[model samples]
Target chain A: MQTLNAMPWATNFWLAIAGLLLVTLVAGLWRIWRGPTATDRMLAAQLFGTTGVGILLALSQAMQQVALIDVALVLALLAVIAMVAFVKRMQGPSS
Target chain B: MNLAFDVLLGIALLLCAAGVFYSRDLFRAVVMFIAFGLLLALVWVRLDAPDLALAEAAIGAGLTGVLMIDAVAHLSAKNAHHQGAQFDQTGARPQLWSRILPVFSAVIIFILLLGAIWWRPDAPVSLPDLVAESLPESGVEHPITAVLLNFRSYDTLLEIAVLLVAVVVAMALKPDTSEPEAGNSKDPILHGLSARLVPPMLVVGVYILWAGSYMPGGAFQGGAILAAALVFLKLAGFGIERLADSLLRIGLALGFIVFLTVATSVMIGGRPFLTYPESVAGELIFFIEAMLTFSIGLILFSLFSQAPPPVAPTSSLQGEQDER
Candidate 1:
C-alpha cells in the first residue's frame, strides 16, 4: 500500500475525519450552552481546545501543510491558560 | 468531502456565535465566545491562511479567553460587594432603541460583507503573486513575514504601537488591590503541573519565534505562547513581580524601538523608509522579529499582571514531603 502522504485519496479520507471532529466540537458547544455551572462551561471549552487541535492535525496531515502542525502545537500547549485563569478566578479572595 | 466539511464548519461557527450572544449567564457567554474563537481559527486553516490560524489560536482564543474569563470573575466579585449601589445606579434595563441599534448595525455590516464577497472581481488580481514576486528582495522566505516585517513594514510598526498603547493603558488602570495570594497549599496539582509545564513551554515559544522566517510560526504566536506560560506560572504561585519593574519594561518597548530605528536608519542611505538592502534584509528582519517577540511577550504579561489574578497556594515540596 502506498504511504498515506503520497496517495491522492488521503485528502478525502482525512477530510472525512475532520468532519467527524467538527461534529464532536458541536456536541461540546451544546455542553457549553447547557452548562449548569461555570466550571461545566469551562470544561466544555477545554474539550473544544483539544478537539480543535485534533482537527488541525488531521488537516495538516491530509493537506501536507506542515505549518498547521505548529498551530496545533501552540493550541495544545496554551490551551491550559484559560483553565488556569478560570480556577484562579474561582479561588480568588472574594470567592 | 471538502464541501461537507466546509458546511459543518459554517454551521458550527453560527451555533457558537448564537450561544455566545443568547446565553443569559455571563460566564457561559464568555466560554461560548472562546469556543467561537477556536472555531474561527479552524476556519482560517480551511481558508489556507495558517498565519491567521496561528494568531487566532494563540492570541484570539487563548489570551482573549483568559482576559475575558478574568473579567467575568472580577465583575462578579465587584457586583457581590456593591450589589445595592450597583442596582440603584445602573440597574435599569437598556432602552429598547439602544439595544436594537447594535443589532441593526451588526446586520448592516453583515450585509456589506456579503455584498463585498458577491462583488469580488472575476480572476481577481493576485496579491499573493505580487507578494511572491518580491519576497526574495523583502528578505523572508514566508510571504506573510516578508509583508509584515519588510515589504509593508509600516503596517507592522503601527501594529506594535497599538500593542504598546494597549499595555500603557492597561498599566494606567488602577491596580487590583488583591495580590495573587502566594503558596498553592489548596491545590498541589497545579503547583506540580506548572513545574513540569513552564520550561518546555518556554522552549517551544522560542522555537516558534525562530521558525517564523520560512514557517507559519512567527513573533506574535511565539510571544503569545510565552505570555501564556508566564500567566500559568503566576497562577501556580511563582512570583514574576520583580521582573515587571525593569526587564519587563525594556522588553515591552524593545520591538518598537528596534523597528523604528531600522526603518529610519535605512532612510539615511537615501532609500525610502524600511527598505532593507537585499544582502542584509534577512538578518535584519530576523533581528526585528526577535525584538518583536520579546516585546509582544512583555506587553501580554503586563496585560495579565496589571490585574493579577489570585494564585492558589500549594507548595509542591510540601506535597512531596506529605507523600513520603
Candidate 2:
C-alpha cells in the first residue's frame, strides 16, 4: 500500500471528487427524507443510485482497482430494477 | 485528505441511518434505508473488503430496496381506507421508555465492538493465512472463493440450504387460489427499453459468475444480478406467466441437487465429502458454481415475483374438499 506522502495528488484528487459526489448524495437523501410523496422519495433514491455509481467509479480509479469498477457497473445496471418495481407498485394492481 | 474523506463518509452513513429510522412514513424510511445501504457499501470499500462492498451494493441496496418498496406498496394498499391513522401500529411512535433500552443496548454494543478491535494483538493469527496456504489445492485463485467453496465448504453448503428453506417457506405461504391475471401494459416505450436492457444484464451476470474464480465477483452477486434482470423483464410487462411451473421447480432445486450429488460422489474416492479430486477440482467447482448461480437467481426472483398472499379467497369446506 502506498503511503500518503507518495503519489499524494492522484489519491487526493480522486478522493476530492468522491467527497463532492457524496455531498450531492447527502442532498438527495435530504429530499428522500422530507418527501411528501412516495414518488418523490423514489426519484431521490434513484439519484442516490447514480451518485453511488459516481462515487464508486472515483474510488476505483483512486485505488487503481478494476474490481471496484465492477461494483459500479452492478449498481448502475441493477439500479433500474428498483425503479421499475416502484413504478409498478405506484400503478397498483389495476394497472 | 484520507482522514477528511473518512470523516465525511462516517457522517453521511450516520445521517442516512438516522433518516431511515426517524422518517415518519414507511415509504420514506424504506427509501432512506436504500441510501443507507449504498453509503454502507462505500464504507466497506474504504475498509478494503471489496467482496462485502459488492454484495452490499447489489443485494442490499438494489434488490432489497425493490423488495421493501414492494412490501410497503402492498401494505398501504391493504390499509388505504384507514389512511386517517397514517401512523398506525407498525409506524406508531414508540413510547419514551421503549427507546431507552434500545439506545442503551446500541451504545453498549458499540463500546464492546470498539474494545474488541482495540484489544486485538499486533500480529494475531489470521484465518487468511491458512486459507492462502491451502488455496493452491482449492482450485480457485481467489481466497474468498476458495474459502467459501473448498476450505470451508460446509458453511457454503449450509448457506445455500438456508436460501432453499427461505424459498420453501415463501412457497408454503403462497395463496392457495389461482394467481391473479396479469396486468400487461401496451406501452411501446417500456417494450423498447426492456428489449435494450435485458441482453446486457444477462451478459453481465454471466461475466460476474465466471470471474468469481479469480476475482471479487461470485455466485451471490451474479445470481442477484440475474434475478434483477428477471424482475426487470417482468416489470416491463413480459408474459412469463406461461412459463411452466415444473421448469421453475426444477431450476429452484438444481443447485442443491447437483452440489450434493457431486459432493457425495466424490466420497466414492474415499477422500471426504466435497473434497474435489485434484485432477477435476476446477471443473467440479465451476460446474457447481454455475448450477448455484441459476438456482439462486430463480429462488430470489420467485420471492420478488410473487405477491404476499392475499386474503385467502373465501372458500367453503365443500369447495376445498372438491378441489382436494
Candidate 3:
C-alpha cells in the first residue's frame, strides 16, 4: 500500500503519454485542414479516433478508473462504423 | 524500471501518427492509422490499462483500419478520375490567429485540467476501495472485468446495443451491391502463403479469448484478431463470399442476442436486470465475452464490406483484388 503512495513513476509515465497524444492531435489537425480529398480528411479523423483512445487510456490510468476504458472502447467501435459509412458514400452506386 | 522502453513506445506512436497525417496516398494513410492504433494500444498497456489496450488494438486499430481502407476503395472507385485532386486549396491559408488560437486553447485546457486534478487533494477514493473490497466475490480476478460485468453489467449490456445500432445504421445507408468480379488473379505465391498463415491466426484468436479470464487478453482482442484473419483471407482471395453471407449476420448478432437473453432471464429469475446468478457469474461473463468477440468481429467486418449482404462468388477473383 505504501508503494502506491510513492509511485511517482506512474504519474510521470502517464504524463509522458498525454504529452505525446497531444502532439499527435496537433499533427492530425493539420491533416484535417490540409487534406487534398474527402478521403484524406476521413483518414485524419481515423487518426483522431486512435489518438482519442490513447488519451482515454492515459486518463483511466491517471484517475485509476476502469470506466473510462469502456468509454474508449465504445468510441473506437463507433469511429470504425462511421468511417465505413463514409467510405460507402464515397464509392457511389455501382456501375 | 525501464524509462527507455517508454520513450521508444512514445516515439513509435508519434512516428505512426505523423505517417497517418502526412501520407500523400489515402490508402497508405489508412494503413498508417492502423499501425498508429497498434502503437497506441501498447502505450495503453504501459499506462496500466490492459483492458483498454486490448480494445484499442482490436477495435481502434484492427476494425477501424479495415473500415478506413474500405472507404478508400469506395472513394477510389467513384473518383477514379479525380484521384489526386486537392481537397483543400485555400491557397496556403496562413492563419497567424487561427493556428495560434487552437494550440493556445488546447494548452490552457490541458493545464487547467491537470491543475484541478492536482488541487483536489480530498477527491473521493471510494471507487478503488469498493473495487478492491468486492473483487473477491466477483468470480473474476481482474478489477476491470469485475467492473465491466459484475459491478457495471448494465452499462456493458447497453454498449452491446450501441454496437448493434451502428451495424444496422450502416446497413440502412448502403444497400447490397452486386459482387465485384474477382479481378486480376492473385500471385499464386501470396495465396499459398495466406493459406498457411490463416489457420494459426484463428488458433491464436481463440487462445486469446480463453486466456482473457486470468490474463490481460479477452474477447475484444480475440475477435479483432479473428476479424483480421478474415480480412487477410479477403485480401488473399479466399472466403470473400462466405464472409458476406449468413455467416456474417450470425456473427454480428451472436453477442447481442446472447447477452440480452441471459440478462432478461436474470430478471425473470427474481433478480434485477443483468444480475448474473452469483454461483456461475464468472462462467456467464466468459460466455458473454466470447459471444461479444464474435459479434464485434462480424459487425466490424460487415462495416468494412459495406455491402448489405454477402457478395456472390465470381470466377475472375476481381472482388478479392478490389478488397486489396
Q: Write down the worst ten-residue block by lDDT for model 2 chain A.
A: A1-10
Q: Which stretches of candidate 3 lie over 4 Å from their true place?
A: A1-95, B1-32, B83-98, B181-187, B241-247, B307-324
Q: Per-residue CA lDDT of candidate 2, range B195-248, in tens? A: 988898889889998988998888888888888888777777786634677887
Chain B TM-scores per candidate, in order, are 0.86, 0.90, 0.80
Best by TM-score: 2
Task: Arrange candidates by DockQ, descending.
Answer: 1, 2, 3
Give lDDT tens digits, candidate 3, residues B1-324: 236556766776777776765555565566567657756765776686766666676566446765665555544444434444332221455557865686689789989999999887885668988998988788787777788777997887788788788878877777455555344245475478566766766776777677666656677677777776666555555546455456667778999899889989988889998888889999999999989888877776666555522232221122222343
On lDDT, the stronger of 2 and 3 is 2
Name the candidate, 1 or 2, with the larger lDDT value: 1
When summed lDDT is taken over every stretch of 10 residues in candidate 2 chain B, the lowest stretch is B312-321
Model 1 alpha-carbon miss at residue A82, Å: 1.1
Candidate 3: what is its chain A TM-score?
0.83
Tens-place lDDT digits, model 1, residues A6-89: 466888888988889999999998888776656677899999999998999999877778888888988988898888877776
- Model 1's chain A TM-score stands at 0.88
Least lDDT summed over 10 consecutive residues: which range in candidate 1 chain B? B313-322
